[model samples]
Target: MKITEQEVHSVAEIARLELTQEEGQKITHALQVILEQTEALKRLEISKVKPTVYVLPLQNVFSEDQLDKCLTQEQALGNAPEVEKGCFKVPRII
Candidate 1:
């Protein structure tokens, strides 16, 4: 689980990153710790445990969509900055 400076440098090169000597050393140590922790976790026995996407039960909190009254075209365009042909006029985007 030990991470080497060479490995850190290789990853940095692949990611197009320019790491300083100190940064590379720090990253190497951090990666070593993470890998060690992951190795420790892999030792756990979870054969009897059921797989779950979430720890807690979840339910939809939103109300069902329903048809509702809509504003008239004139009412909808009343506050528009600019209107043309009974619709909002937007700047051309080509």
Candidate 2:
């Protein structure tokens, strides 16, 4: 697709940007070059290639889940300096 200076101006207006004539022309040319470069990529053969979220194989690295013995609430708060209504009490922040 060919990019035009008018298109650049339109985009600039939408972005609330004030581009000089030179900057607009430069941006238009740059966009045109980018589009032209992408044209070569359009010729790649991918008929047999399946679309994927990842380009490489991915696997879970996490360990297996298992139930184990845990401390009770009374044991957990056994060493607390302050405990109020079965909860730890911290200094109030201003």
Candidate 3:
């Protein structure tokens, strides 16, 4: 899992990245540590633990629907830039 500067440079060449020599060495070491950590995770024992879908309990706390007063046709269409035959006239797409 240990990545070297030559491997990082090869990957950078494939990805079209122009990393400096110092940056390439830094990236190689960082990538090596990440792979080592992932490898270490494989050694953990969790066979007796049950898998969980949600981390926290979820519940609906919304209020019930209620009726309300509505606006008239003239009030709703008052802000239209163009109207024809009691309806808004929009530009045709096709």
Candidate 4:
């Protein structure tokens, strides 16, 4: 699982990154370490462990939805800096 200098350069090109020689070497070494660590983890035995989606149980904490009255059009538009034809107006994009 050794990462090579060429591989690092290839990845840098794909990402449109400009890496100095020292930075490229450092990245290659770091990638090698990560791959080695992942390989080590793959050797661990966890056959008896149960699969879990979350580390802790999750519950909905929000209150139930209730019908509510909304503001009228004039009330909603009252704070607008600019309004036209009963709606907010802004500069044309095109």
The lDDT, on a scale of 0 to 1, for candidate 1 is 0.91
> Model 2, 1-94: lDDT tens per residue?
8888998999999999999999999889989999999999779998888888887787776866888889898998999999999899899969
Q: What are the candidates' C-alpha RMSDs?
A: 9.1, 12.3, 11.4, 8.1
Per-model TM against the reference: 0.48, 0.50, 0.45, 0.47
Best by TM-score: 2
CA lDDT scores, all candidates in order: 0.91, 0.91, 0.88, 0.90
Higher TM-score: candidate 1 or 3? 1
| Location of the lowest summed lDDT over 10 successive residues in candidate 1 | 55-64
What's the lDDT of the predicted structure labeled candidate 2?
Answer: 0.91
Put down candidate 1 lDDT per residue, 36-93, tens digits, no spaces.
8899867899888888888778867686699889999999999999999998999997
**Higher-ranked by lDDT: 2 or 3:** 2
Predict model 3's lDDT versus the native. 0.88
Q: What is the lDDT of residue 91 in candidate 1?
A: 96
Residue 9 displacement (Å), model 3: 0.4
Superior by TM-score: candidate 1 or candidate 4? 1
